[model samples]
Each structure stands twice: as C-alpha cells, then as structure tokens.
Target: MPLPGQQSPLMIHWEASPEKQMDCQQKGKNNKTECFNHVRFLQRLNSTHLYACGTYAFHPLCAAIDANRFMLPSHFEEGKEKCPYDPARGYTGLIVDGGLYTATRYEFRSLPDIRRNLHQRPLKTEESPLHWLNDAEFVASVLVRESRDSPVGDDDKIYYFFTERAGEETTSFFDKSHVARVARVARVCKSDVGGKKILQRKWTSFMKARLVCYIPYYEVLRSVCSLDGGGWASTVFYAAFTLSAQWRTMEASAVCRYSISAVQRAFEGPYMEYQDSTRKWARYDGAVPEPRPGSCITDHSRRKGYNSSQDLPNSVLDFVKLHPLMFEEVKPAGGEPLLVKKSVAYSRLAVDRVQALDGRSYDVLFMGTGDGWLHKAVVVGSGIHIVEEVQVFRDLQPVESLVISHAQRSLYVGAASGIVQVPLATCARYTSCYDCILARDPYCAWDGRACRATATMDSTGLVQDIQSGNKGCRSISGRGSLPWKNRTVLQGDDVLLPCDQRSNLARAVWLLNGSEVLGMGQDRLRVGVDGLLVTDTLPQHSGEYRCYGEERGLQTLLAAYSLTVLPEIPRSPTAATPPHAASQAANDMKVAYISAIVTLVVLCAVLSTILLYMSCLEKRKGKYVLGEPRPSSVELQTVSANCLRKGHREEEEEEEELTYPDGCLRIIPGEAPTAATSPIKELPVAVPPLPPPLPAELTNGMGALPNVLRKMNGNSYMLLQQQEEPLVSPLYSASFTEELSKILEKRKHTQLVEKLDESSV
Candidate 1:
C-alpha cells in the first residue's frame, strides 16, 4: 500500500489550511472519499501526540492529532471501512491503545469484506436481527463496562444504540411498515481484535440486544452520561429524538429512556436463524456457542494464556459472526417513560436526578427540539411530563449536541451557529406561592423574598412542601416596623394608587374605605397600570386605601396606604372673575352709554333755541325806541290841566312836565291818563333811566308808567338817529332812544319776565 520501497508514506503538514479543505474546493475531483466526513474526539495521550482520523479521507489517514496539529503515518490506515469521508455515511466508534472498534460498513473499493476484527453490521438475511440496519440510522455509542470495573481484570466492552427498519419489511419487496423502533444495544469486546489469518483484524464477539424506548431517528443523539445501578448489572441511557423531514412518525415528538439490563437479556436469549427447507428464518433453540461470546472475558481466560480473540480458533469466530443478534425485544425501565412530550422534536438531551421538597427524587431532563425550544420535564407518578418549554434559539437553529454542568446548574446546547448556556432553573423570577405552585417544577421553592432552590434535604420525598405567597411582608418576614404607605392628591385631579405585584398568578385586590374597589371597566374608578386609579379625586376620596393578594382563599396584605385629597387652591383674578358682578357692570355701562348720547343731543338743541330767541328779542326791542320814532300821521292831543287833575283826583297830583318816550306814546284829550282807559293797549318795552325832559309840544303829552316795563340803572342801548340836530330844534334828550340792552338781564331763579310782541308801523 505504501510506495513500494518506503516503509510508510508521509503526510505533508503546515500551519496553513488543512488539505481536506482543498479537496472540497476542486472542480474536477468529484469523489465521495475526497474529504473528511465525521470526527470523533479522542484523548490527548501526551503533550506531543493524540489519536484521530479524517474518516473516509482521500488517503485514508489515521492515528493523527495535535493541538497545532499533526498526522500519523499512513500505515495505520488499516481500511477505508474504519472511517468514511462522505457526510451521508454514519458510524459509532471509539479508540484505545491504537486499536479501533466500531459498528460500520466493512468494505474496500465498494466491495464487502466481512472478515474484520469487529463485525457490528448484520447479515442481509430477512430474518437476521442486524438485517434491520440495512436502512437504519446509528444513534450513539459509549463504553459501558471497562476492565477496571471487574476484580478479575476482564476485557472492556462498549454499548451501541441505534434504530432500524423492522424485520417484516425485509421479507416483502412492496409490503413495508413505516413504523420503526429503537435498536437498543450492540456490544464488542476490546480483546476481540483479530489476529493473522482467519477473520484477521475482525471482531470475534460482536452481538446486539434491544434497548427499550430509545428514539433512534437520528444518526447520533449523543450520550453525555449514564446512570448505573452500582456497576453494570443495571443501567439507563437518556437520549433525544428529532423528527426528520423525510418521515412523519408521530404528530408530536418525544424523548425516550432505555435500560442496559433489558439490552443484556435480549442478547442472551435465543437467536433467529435461517431454515433452508422452508426458505425462512426461525428462532434457534438447539445449541448456543461456548465461551458465552457476548460476555466479558475473566482473568481465568488469561490464566489459560488467552488474551485477545486471536487466541481463539476460527470455528468459534465464524459462529459468532453468524449469530450477531439476540431474540428478545427490550422494554423501557419501570415499563414507562421518565419524560415524554409532544409538538416538539427533541434532538439532544441531558438529564440530572434531583431531590424535591416532597422527600422524593426526580429526573430533570433538558431536551432540545428542532423547533428551537428547550423543554424541561420531570419524572412524576408513573410518567414523564413537561414542566415548561423555553425558547432558547431565537433564530431557530437546529440543536446538534448538549452538555451539562451540574455544579453550575446549567446545560450548554450546541448548534452549527453557536452555543447557548441555559440555567437548569430560574426560580428567582417567580416570587409568589401561586406562581411557584403553577410552575410545577421540582427544583424551585418560594422563599421569603424570592423563589429559591434548596439543596439540603434529609428525606427522599420532600418535593411537595412548597406553598406560600409573596405578601404580608411584615408578618411573614417578622419586620412589621416598616413605614406606612401614604399618598396625597389634589381634589379633581387624576390619581393612581400604586400596588406593584411581582407574582403573575396571584390576583391583586384593591380596598377603599374598608371595602372592595370597583372593577376595571368603570369610569373615574378603574384598575390602571400600577394598581387602582381615581380619575377624578374628590374630597370624599380621602381615606385609607389598601391592596391584598389572594391565593387559595387565603389573603395577604400586600400594601396599605392613607390617601388624602388636598383642597384645590384658587386661581388669580386675571384668570377668574365673579360672574354676578361682571354681568351687572356690563348692564350698567350699556345703559349709561346710551343715556349720555341722548343728553348731549338735547342740550345742543336747547342751547341753539335760546340763542336765536335772545337775538330776536334784542332786534324787536330796538323797534320800541321812541327817540327816533318814525313820523306817524295819527294826531296827538295835549291833555288839559283840569282833565289831568280830574284823572289824578284819586291820587296827589303834581303839575310836572314828564318827558316820556313820546316818540311812540299818543294821548287823546278826552281820555283819562290811565292804561285801562286807552283804546289801544301798548306793548311794554325795556327803558333806561330818562336823561333830560323835553318840551311838551315837541313830544306826546302822556308820560307812561307800566308795571310790566322795568327800569335799569344806566347801563343800556337804544336805536338813536345820528342826524345833526339844530340847536333851536328843541334840544331833545337824544341819548334816550330806547334800544333794549341785552334782551333780558340775568334773571333770578323765580323771575317771571313778561313777553313782548313784535309790531309794524
């Protein structure tokens, strides 16, 4: 296989990229074995060396590893069947002391070669148990019983789990059942590594048994850890199953459990063999091979100088390959599941056995699903059920593997994109008893302030003791000295009474005046964001308000408060005014405004009338001036002395020449000198004091005196003619013409002045 002369071929290496990465990049190089497919992590034996393989690589390199990295000599690449490079192929394997034992195809150049040190694949016979692997998926593998566990220094044995098609389908070409099951356990001994000639480098004791209730839909639902009953006599394996797109098995998905005890029994029972006469395989009951092929080899074999399968004969090895499968079908532990669920295809699983407050133990299973949700389930009475489902992957990436760290109370789930670290339980968020009880998780218990996980317990069934509410803080915590809650709001303003509650399951009750508050749908009073709200606070609203939490008909005083409504302060005058005063002022101004306008108009008219009347009276008074009287044709007669004396007989008569305003006065000789005896009633006019008397011939004889005509002291005006008066023409008193002064002098408040009429000559 090496270049004829060389001892072994060399693997070129550098710090650059791996050679396999280039294989996938080549355009013309189209081969399935060109690149590495699966990688199984082996241990680092030392600082300089480790064991690994680029399973199904172009050169089939093996036993290669390093931190920076290195490749082993090509000579260790025993066969291509050990590790395939194609991604579509799958296998379960382990490495120890440079020897590899696995359940994989035994082939070279696409041809079958059954004479290998390990033979995990079954025959193609319709009745063969391994015949199911024809179209099956290999789930996972792990070492079960090691040589150190045996006091006699026995060989190491590994257990493999998988799922395959049912045997009935192998017989019918068309009639096939889609239903499948968990192909439980298959084992191969370490010492069975083949020796030189017959069955060389092939397994001598490879056998398979059924494991109960495991989901084998995946190629490898990796096994993190196993729980053992003391040693290997009884054990359980926890696994996750994902619903594949190619097949629809169940409407919902689930996580399944398996037991090693069931698998061991299935391997020790009768084997199904082919009956040539009937052309069918029947259950074999005649004889079983000696040395118990599936059992571990004790030190007694070593005492007989037998170490590996190479020490055994070819006839015994040939018999083992023919009967690789046992007859009995396995069942799950307790005849039921530890945890089961639906609607979520669980693809990866990690489990922990924990103690609860009820003094009982429970298995807490963390299962990852294809839908990106992580389901947490617990083992409860006769069945497994989900406690809660959490969304771990926001982007919906598929979960490929899972790892648990019990010390940190976390599970690390890995995907192609990244890994997420999730806590086993987040108990602090649920602080109330109603919230804690409804969660139904075994790890959480409501403490005084939060939901806490308690690890110390003396009894087995102690999980059921958790029940309490997160209220009545003063009483429950024994610290009632806390200050009283108080609130104040102005009247007619919206107010919110706060009662912040942390528990989602508990109902908050608001109390006002020692009675229940109205429900949320009411106006003015309602349950708002923080707690209760009085949309409009009034003076009557000032009272004690309280909030309580109710759970299981039990009450807890959550908070208490004294609410006081302050009276509203008045606003400034610019903002508000008395309505009554404002209306009265407006009315008064309206009336006064109208009245003043009317009085101004009337006073102007009255003043104008009085001025006109005064001007006319002055003009008419000028006409009454006798000093320049117009020449009248009427005859005047002088009164005799006897007549004047007789007219004045009743009074003391004086013979005095009285010069009157003779310009208009005329007398009749036969008439008495009184005003009533006169035929014409003359109008009286204003007169100034007489200046000097004139001759009787030059003026009318009558000198008049009327009570209606009054005299002023000397201030006067009159109509006087400005003609040259001849000295002999009887010097008349020219200054006394008789034009009235301003028509009427200022009159007294009670004065009644006589009216004068206009006249024409």
Candidate 2:
C-alpha cells in the first residue's frame, strides 16, 4: 500500500495454484476468502531484493520481489519452513546476513518449528521428544550482532521470542503446570552447526529460557521490539505481555524490557531437567561436561580443541540435547514491568530514540491498542508518561503491525482494514506552551513562539522536558486561568460544563465554589468523561465550577463556568384560568369533595348496621335453638318431684309443698318433695318395680327433661331409690313418667323404712 502523498498504490496479482485453491475451498467449507493469498511475512533480503511469503490457499509459497520496481519474480520457492500454512497462526521471520531465520508451523498440524533457510544445508529444530516447543506462538525474531573485539569471545546470536504452553518441566502451581502461558526467549549461535554423532541437522547451541514479566505466572508475549544500543551490552528487547484470556477477567497489558546481558546470564545458568520419580522439574545437580554444553563456539571453545560443533565431544552434544531449558529466567531490566495499563490490550509496539531539545535522548514508545488507538509514551527516568492517544482506525480493530520510519518521521499502523501513517511528532496540535509542556513529548517543544516538532526546527531557544515537564518548564507554570463563562439555567433543568483533556495521564477533576466536587454516585450531580453534569439544578447548584487536569501533582485549569440557577417561573393565574371561572371551579371541587365524604360515611354506616343485625340474629339463634329431637310439652301434674336421699342426713319428718306454675314445677326456696304429694298419685297408671340399671347414654338423655325435675334434688335432683334406674327419654310420656314415679315411690317407701330403722338404731 502507498503512504500519504506517495505514488498510487502498486498492486501485484499473487494467487494460489488452481488445485490448491480448489482444495482450500473444499476443506474450508467453500470459504472463498480463505482460498486467496494471504501475505504472512515481508523481509528485506538485501538492498535490491525483498523476501516475501504467503499462505497461498492450503499451500505456502515464497518469492523475491524487486525493491525498486515492486515486482515479484516469475518463479516461486516452497514456503514450508519460511511461512505458516495456517494464516491465523502466529509466525515470525527475519532475514539476517542473507539467511532467513523463521519460527513457524511448517505443516497443517501447526506444530512448532524453528529453522534457518537459505543455507547450504537447511537446518531446523528437533522434531522428536517435543520438549523444545509446545503449541508455540511466535511473536518476533531478531539478530543480535556481537562485539568481535570483546575479550570474552562471543558469537552472533539469533533470538526468537514466543509464547508457548508450559510443559511438564514447569515447576508452577498444579493448575498451571500444563497449560500456563510461558513467555520464552530462545537463542542459537550464528556459527552453530549440527552435532557430530549424537544429533544431526539440529542446533547444538540452542538454549531457551523463561521471560518473567511482572507476574510469576501467566506471561503471554504479545509483541516484541528490539533496540540496538551501540553494543551487545547495551542492546535490549522491549516486550509487551498480557495475561491469558482464560486467567483474567479484565484485559491488561504491560511493557517489560530485557537486557542482552541478563539473557546471556540466564543461558549460562544451570539447566532444568524433569525428574521422573518426583514428577517435577528441578535444577540439574549432575556435573556438566567440559567446554560447557550449549555454549557457542567461542575463543574458549576454540582453545579447548572444540572450534566447531562437529569437533565437540558426543557427551557435550548429548547433554545439550537432553537439557535445552535453563534454570534461571530472564526477568525485566528493572525486575518489574515498565508500565501496566488496565482495560487495554496492547497488540503492537515500536520504539524510536528521540533527541529532544533539552540535549538528551529519550525512547519514545508507540504502542498500538486492540481498540485501534495508538498511544505515544516517553520513557523518563524510571517511569513512562503517556504523551497522547491518536485514533488510527474508525473501527475498533486490533493493530496487526507497527513500523517506525525515522526518515519520514511517521508511524505506520497496520490493521485488518488498511494502514495508517501517523506523524511521529504531532506538535501543532498543542495550541499553547502549557499543553506542550504538559504533554512531555520528547519530539515536540515550544520554540519561544509556537509548539513545533524538534526534528523540523532548531533547538536553540526551544523548551522541552523529557523528565517531569513541570520541573523543567517552571517559567510557563503561572499561566492565566481559563475565562469562566456565565451559564444561566432555570431550576430543574440540567447543565453541562465540558472539559477536554489531551493527555491520558492527567486526571480530570471538577471543582465547585473552590471545593472539590465528589459526585460520583449522586443522582443530582455527576462527573462524566468529558464534563461535569448538574442535573435537576437548584439554588444550591449556583456556584463557580472549574475543571482542572492534574498530572504528577501539578494541576492546570482547563475549563471554568460560573453557574447561576434561577427559580422556576410560576404560571400566572390569568394564563391558567379567569378569576370567576377559577372561583366556580373551586366551589365545584369543594362540593364534590363534600359529597364524596358524605357518601363514604353513609356507606360505612349502612355496612355497620347490617353487620350488627347479623350479629344479633346469630346470638338469638344460639340462645333459643335446640340441637336435635324437640322436647315434648308434658304437664307437671303427671310427674312427681322428689329430693335425692342424703345418707348422712336424719330422716325428714315433713316435706314442703311443691307448686306448679305455668306448667313448670316450682318448689319453695328451701323445700324437699314428698311422695304423698307427688302428681303420680293422681295418675291411673299402676306402679311397677324398679327397672334395671340404666346405661350412661340414658342418664345423659334425661338431662333434657322439664325444669320441674331439674329444680328438685338440687337443680339435677333425682329420687335416691330410682337413681339406679334413671329415666332415658329426652321428654317423658305420661305413662312412662307414671311408671317411673311408681317405681320411685316403691323404692322411696323401702328407703324410708330403712331410714327409720337407721334412726332408731
């Protein structure tokens, strides 16, 4: 694709073979998109030629392009080892010294493989044992050129950075033992060839070590950028790492720097070996062979009669073959991440060394986010300050690649859609010195007049601060506060006071009447991303509002507003209704209200009256209603009333008269009934002997007899002689009563004789 203001984009028609395209379409379920040629890598092989590879449908293809003409050669080479067969799989390749070094999946299975092509004898990693790589995702590759003049002789190295699943050799927690995402840095000596006898066509100087970022677990490599710092001692690798998606709930990213010396030390450490008995990984305690296994063919090796890999002893090669993993990990330069950002997934990174107007150099990092934003940050001392954020793509898409062009002074961002060329220095965007200084951009400075790019102007009289911007640019601190705009808003209406911040590092704070507004969860007031919102404005809301941006303990007023909340206007009576009409309406309302109240009261009274009537009827029924078998109305003249005998009492010589009133037998307040005055005497029925003993049910039935019998014998009186044969009728017939009275009289006569005898005794 063409850059901005460049020539029209030159197109090259590259397609897969007919057979390959047909197979891919069939295998991918007729997905024509996947059948097209997808470019995987493009590396400058030389000044005149470029090496490019692609996933041509199901087949991989490679070709050399003319750099000047931007044309591909007619003939193509097999890209089996140089490119990935699966376009979605991660792979990295680099052309160093006319040799292509690649870490990729060579076949359809997506097995991890690292190889060096374009050599007399093409070489690759071990295919068996599978300990070198496990589901590896290649991120980047670089060639670190060694200093030929060093006293401790060292050979050039090709380092490959990738993330892979942890193997059984990892000593992490049980849950992470097999599936932990481990960031790894593997290096091979440039002069290394295959072993002589033990291993052939495999790297003899291959050694891999873990890359520890901030956390000790879940380190996944996202992107890597290599910076050449004059010598091997100064060279460093900046890597972006993120937690595995399966291990984190929120997205996070960190930038960690690895120095070359630290990596070398890790490689020189003891090897990690798996113990079958313990089923754990531990440092190897066995003695290492001389000339040190996995060491480059340096001057020391040359002096040990091992100048080349072919001359090394089989013992050394065998040891190197078994122990390729180092015990120590290559931690970050500062033993921690340079910067960690939450809710952001960094996809690509490009670092540029910027010479600022302050006569110092700073490393500016261009980090691409998954949300299609480019974050520019400067490394100052022990911290990183985010200078600005630029929207690279309108749609939210992960940035696939980032390229920095020092000559064009631009950053090229590549996504799934297209590439965007962003200028490295966006100085004119800063309108004032305060903004420019607050940005802390190493590429931009205030040239005593306007904010300008340091690369495009002279540094004399220019102000720039790569460190804390407030400390270096103290003269520009006393800038005038923003003019407060008067805002007149009616009560109950909402008011919005806007404030825009250019730097993401600055925290936006809203202050009302010289007090900080902490209305995070309040309903009446709120703090939005870009402004302060006063909802349902009242008299208390009338105050001076100011938005200040604070960064590194320095505060700058960005926006201000003088808010005046006026009372809500009341509707006029004339506008609402005429006075006479209003009076009539009020009278009607009052009458309607009184009518409703009277109706409610009347309804309640009626309901209460009905309830009272029902209660009275229920009481009358309970008082007068009889259960079953209605009683017979027998005259009292037929029944004889008598008192029950008291064994302890002396015999009564005289009995009181019993009176029958209203067909009910009544006795004097203290009177006993005698058989001679009984009504049974008047009845013509003959007397009978006493009957058998009555059942309990018969005794219970006799309780419903007339009150005359009940009043005799003390309310439930009974004749003692006939007590054993009590009456059994709910109401007695005249004949039955006569019979009962006759039996009772006979028993009474016998009882009287017994009583007389007892008295005489």
Candidate 3:
C-alpha cells in the first residue's frame, strides 16, 4: 500500500469511472490506461506527496500506485509543443531542476480527430532545427551519462536512442521505405535550460549519430572495460542494425559495438551539409566554425561569456543546423557480429559482465524478441552460446523494454501488456551436472547449493573445470535413474526397453547381458525415438537390457531392465484347438478309429482263409509220398580221405629216409661192395594239389569232428591235448620228447650199410 520506502502507507481507489468521463472508457482503447502509463516518481516534494509524470497516459500525474488523488500541471500537454497523449507514441525523459527533459513527438492522432493509420512527417517551421525529432519517430531507450573527470554531477548529458524517417527519398513510391527509416540518436547537455526568447522551453544543443551494423533501433548496450591506474574507464555502445532494401539488405540482424569516444569525435568532427545541386547530403570540406556548435558549456567556455548555445553567434548555429549529423560512419567492433538473427527482430537487450569459473570474465547478453521470447547468450571462448530461451509472455507479444537489476540477479521486461520479472540465471533448472556444465553460461554456477549467479565481474570459482567437459561433474556420483524394472514376455512376442535420460547432451547405448548391442542392421534389435524396441524376441533375447548414456568418453548406466522370455508350451492336438474345434476333431477321430478296426478284422479273416486253403493243397499233393527216400532221388555225401586213394600216406613216405643202390662205390673194390647211399632229392609237384584232409566225421557231420589227423588250416602238425597252460609252440612238437634218439640210431645204421655194401662190391 505504501511506496518502496515510506513510513506510512499511501491510499488509492478506482478513480471516477472513465465514462463518468464515457470519454474515459475510450482513454486506453487505443493506447494504455491513464493510471498505469509509464509512471515515474520524479521527486519527493513532501512526506505525504511526490512529484511524478505518466508522460504517455495522464500527462505528468503526481500520484502513488494506489493514490486516491493525483496532481500535475494543467498545461502539461495542452500546448501543441508539449508531451504527446498517444500511448502508441514513445519518448525519452529525465528530470532536472523541476523541469522534465522529454524527447518525443507531441502529435499523431487526437481523440477529436479519428483518422486512418497515418505517419507523421516533419513540419517546416521557424524552430525546426530546435525540435529536431522528426514525425513518425519512435523513442527506444534513454540514458544519462556523467563526465568521469568532472566532480559536478549536474554536468551530465542525456541521450535518446530511436529510429525515424530518413530525409532521403527512395525510388519507389508507396513503399514502406519510400521515406526510408534510419536508426538515429540524439543527445543534449543537461545544463542548458532554454532561451527565454524565440527558443523558450526548447533544447539548445541537440545532436544525432547514425549506428551502422545490420539494423539499428531499439537497444544500445554499453561496454565498459577497466584500465590500469584507474584514471578513467573506456565505454562503447553495442547496437543492432537492419535494412528493408531487398537488394542490399543484411542476411541477419548484426550487433556492433561503437566506441563512445568515436561517437563524441563524430559529433565534434566534420559535418554533412546539404548539397542543393545533388539534392543530397554531402561532406562539408569547408573551414571549421567558431565557438564549436552543439557542444555542452565547459568550465573554460563559461569564463568566455559563451556558456550556452543562445549566447553563440548565428554563424555557429547556422552551421550546426546544416550539419546536425556526424560525417563519419562509426566503425563496428571487430568480428562478424556479437549476435545475428535472420527472422527475429530483437526488441530489447540488457547486458552484464560475468566471471566464469575459469577466472575469466564473460559478457552475457540477454536479448528480447518480438515473439515474447528472451534469449540468454554468453560469450564463451571466441563464440556465443545461447544457454536458454525463455518465453516470458503467454501471448507472444513484443518485448518492448528490458532492465537488468544486477544487485538482484534478475531481469525485468516490459511488454505491450505488462512488465515481468525473472531470474538472470536458470542453471538451477538443469537438474544434472552434465546439463549445467554443458550450458556454458558464465553467469551460472553450481555453487554446491544450487545453480546460483555471481555478480562479480571477475570470478570463476563455480565452474573452474567446465571447459574440461564433464570433469566438472566428476565429483557428482549420485543416481537419478529409476529403480530396476523386471519385465516378462512370451517367446515370439516383442519387447521395448525404456531409456528416460532427459539430457540430449549424451548418446544412448543399448546393452544385452553386459555386452554392447549393435543398434544398426538388427531387425530384432533397434533404438526407437523414446526407447529401444526389440522385435520377435527369442530365448537368447532374455537377459538384462541396460541403457547407458555416453557423453564425452564417459559411460553412465541410465536404466536397467531384467527381461525374461518364457518358453513355449507344447499342447496336444485337441488341446491346441478351441473347445468348439476340439469337440469336432474328437468326433472325426472316433469315426476314423472305428473304420480302421473294421478293416483290420476283415483283412485277418481273409488271410486265415487263404492259409487254410494252401495247407489243404500241400497235404493233398504230399498224400502220394511216403516217409522214405524217393527212388529217383540220390543223396550226395562227403567221403573220408581214408576211403579214397590214401594220397596223404605218400606225403608221409616223402618224410622217411630215402635209399639207392651203390653203383658209384663198385669202382672202389677195396671198399668190399660198399653201399652207395645218398639222400634222394624230392621232385616238385606239377599238378594242382588236392584239398587238405578233413576228419572222418568232418566230411559228413563235421560239426562233431575230433582232433586225429585233423587239417590244421593246411599244416599237418600233430595235435596235443590242451594243457593247463595255453602256449603257442610252432617249432616244439608235443610228441618230440623222445623222437630225437630214433633219428640218431637210424643215421648210424645208414652209414654202416654204406660201408658194408662198398666192401662187397
């Protein structure tokens, strides 16, 4: 109920109904309500009251937010040259010595004059150069600059930034730029009150400068850099520029910074005078004018009796009138642009210097657009990063004005409908360290408490290792993933694994049974937009399905799924079918069984009848035969070798000692007819030999054959009774235990016979 700092509360109520004025209902229809229009508490005249002005709505009303009564000068905008009443119009204002320094047009459309949308054109008048603002001009921002060298604060100057109709006419008629719109700025010394004569209540030293970049209007941000020894800091104004010319327009809105010193030199530099022959403004190479026009009265000039423009000669004033604009186009800051926007028109900008965690200072720029969106951009290592885009207004109306409260770490935006306040830092919204670090906003820091903002221009303790990528998050080791989920699916069915990591800064990878899965070329395995979808699952598909986030060479498991695939159940024929189908199948199978049993019975009876007929025929055919051998039949039996030629005995005789007549010994008479005995050489067999001998019973019932004279697989070795010890003795005969002596006596007799036969011969 009270002002920001007050001992007592001020009171207010809804004023007399606007229609109590019907005229009041129409008050805000075109512009804004009188009570809420750009109200400023100009000064505190007393404890109970204050001096204020709502320049656009209710002309200079001195009232509180809820004040029941309001007061102001009756002729605030009553005169034609005073403040404008149109809410659609804009202005720049400052208070000094009880008088308001306002720069804006005083007329557009009045209530009594209802007209179509019309543009204001500069009117030619005797005081044209004094009220320098052209028609159809819009005031953007106002600033008060003080001289750092001077101790007196009253020596300050006021600057108005805006866009207005350019004096140059284009080739096309009826075009928006037929009267080209150019970015323009005007500044006036605060010390100049006015001339009491012809220029009463008008500015004396009003001058302007052209800001070049892409498009110029609306916003002017200051760049202040500290210098050594702290004599004075340098300043620059970063402005945005654009163009409507289709042929030569900028590709994007370009932001450029112009040195404040250059702006001053341009104002005090050579002038651009009108050339009548070319009907265009050309540089004036003429000699400089005396006393220097359009400059504030300095300490040195005041002693010379020329403290203000009114005291200056007409020659200086005429020269200033012809060259109110600077001759040189201020060069922009080096680089492509501080910011570029192709389609969006940046409505307002507020800038602040931030100290990063790496101990570097960064300039953070907040630009508001006509689409009700605010873009927070941070200067990071030779590049600009837009950390976040916040939608301030619901209706997407143009963000008309912006203010930065550095002390509060908050931003206040003025829109077409109302004003909104928001925090300057949104790093807290990022729930994870990865997200917060990836934002690269110098104004934001984790700070271990929350994502807080630092106001110091040179600090970086919040994110010292932020440039090392996720190293800033290496200390963060908590889990935010959901609890492990268990899922069961029947074989041949499909399954999907959920991946719910919200940050896009990480890549999601799928794993099965602790092994990475190839996301591509797998018809059954793939990653979907929201999760991993596995088609036609098999038994091998049963395992732990994990989703891991891969960011900057680090892998983090985000979710796990214990997936189990159930085996298929085997069913009987009937069980495999529905109840209705099963019943029908049972009936059909029963009929098949009965038909099979009947066919088997008939087949058995037929086969039995055929067998009996065949048995009867065999008995009838065999009836004439007796149980004796037939007369015409003969039995061929195998005869024993003993009943044959006894050829085996000849083989026995060959082994006996051979004898011969001693015909060669007759020549030796003295030897008394010695027997000429020599061992006979056996002749080789010429014919094919007969088969080896078989035993007597072996020839006929050889199954019962004995071992006597048995054919031992073609060798006639004597058979021995099998002894307790089974040993193979091929060279040791079983009967040769005493046969060695017989052989010695037989050889002695043969020798004696040979000697006797030799003596007889």
lDDT by candidate, in order shown: 0.53, 0.73, 0.53
> What does candidate 3's lDDT look like per residue over 1-761, in tens digits?
66778856533332323433345345544333543344432444345544444433344333322123444433432223334555445554444433445555545453111010101211112245332444534444333455557653225565666665555323344355344566665666766544435344444566776655543332232211111122222554556554455434433455555555666666777776666787666677888766676777776567778766567666766665566666665555563466666776676666777656666666777878778988887655544566778889999797777778877778998887888898887666866665666667676666554565555432444653345456666644333575779999988898878787655556787878876674857768878657888788888888888787776655566788899999877778865787888766654333333333333443344345544644564575443222233245322222222322334444367743212111111112222332233122332322222323322122222121121221123322223332323332222243332322333333333322212222221
lDDT of 3 at 127: 40
- Candidate 2 stretches greater than 4 Å from native: 1-9, 28-30, 168-178, 472-484, 490-494, 508-529, 533-545, 553-555, 567-761
lDDT of 1 by residue, 263-382 (tens): 667777877664568744467686665556545567876677666667765566656656666667666667655554455566667778776665666677777777677877776655
Counting clashing residue pairs in each candidate, in order, gives: 29, 1, 28
Candidate 2 residue-wise lDDT, 341-370, digit = tens: 888889999998877776777888999999
**Residue pairs that clash (backbone atoms under 3 angstroms), model 2:** 713-717
Scored by TM-score, the top model is 2
Candidate 2's TM-score reads 0.71
Worst 10 residues of 1 by lDDT: 739-748
Q: State the RMSD for candidate 1.
A: 32.5
TM-score of each: 0.50, 0.71, 0.55
Worst 10 residues of 2 by lDDT: 702-711
- Arranged by lDDT, best first: 2, 1, 3
- TM-score (C-alpha) between model 1 and the true structure: 0.50
